[model samples]
Target: MAMMKLEHVGIMVSELERSMAFYTDVLGMELVGTLDHNTPGIRLAFLSYPGQTAQLELIEGYADRLPDEGQVHHVAITVDDIEAEVARLRAKGVRFLDEAITTLRNGARYIFFAGPDGERLELFQPPRG
Candidate 1:
């Protein structure tokens, strides 16, 4: 009952720099900060929108081999224009799992794509007014 809002979602990554670039350069998230995790051989990096507090934490050196779907099933980022966002990512060589955007019963549209570390990422558009 004390929970206020979703703070962050952390995903394991192999290479910190590469994953950071994918989220920052390709996805357009701003790099919040990077730091050495308490555990040895582990590093942490946080990213978010230019002026937002909620973050996506990228953790490195947690696992030697990552599964195809990675640890997290998928991380969805809300978008205003799903089509334009898909086109933008496609131009950057991003691979999508879904051939076309999926429309939900409530008119929400979404599409899944692979991240640098093979983590699933989704772009979602809520119903229009």
Candidate 2:
């Protein structure tokens, strides 16, 4: 047997709106679609970029149910407005992991944050110089 190609990454979020803001606004990913789907014991919203097949499945309805160890680390999302996005999200009450910002010698800047479900996520500003 052979494992098929990767399909998508599933992230169980405690709050949908918080995930939406970080993925859509902060990361600048299009909210291709969302739904209140149901199967047997779970439901979630499927999100992805336009013309992209792989998706980001934001699983919800898991209130305070922490995943097993090594559930997830963090996904790097490229952003052009690192400063502005950080400010906006901060105003929205999104606490960041690091107390300050960090910029690399390659002209790239980045920061980390904890998602609504305690999912560690990162935003990176590509090298512009």
Report lDDT per candidate.
0.79, 0.67
TM-score of model 1 vs. true structure = 0.54
Q: Model 2 lDDT vs. the true structure?
A: 0.67
Tell me each candidate's TM-score.
0.54, 0.45
Total residue pair clashes for candidate 2: 0
Question: Least accurate stretch of 10 residues (summed lDDT) in model 1?
Answer: 1-10
Query: What's model 2's lDDT at 84?
Result: 81
- Top TM-score prediction, candidate number: 1
- Taking the tens digit of each residue's C-alpha lDDT, what string does model 1 give over 22-103? 9999999999878775458988787999888678879899889888886754576777888888888899999999999977
Candidate 2's residue-wise lDDT over 5-67, tens digit each?
233556777777788788988887777556554333345555777788566767667445756
Steric clash count of candidate 1: 0
Top model number, lDDT: 1
Q: After superposition, how far is residue 91 of candidate 2 from its true place, in Å?
A: 1.0
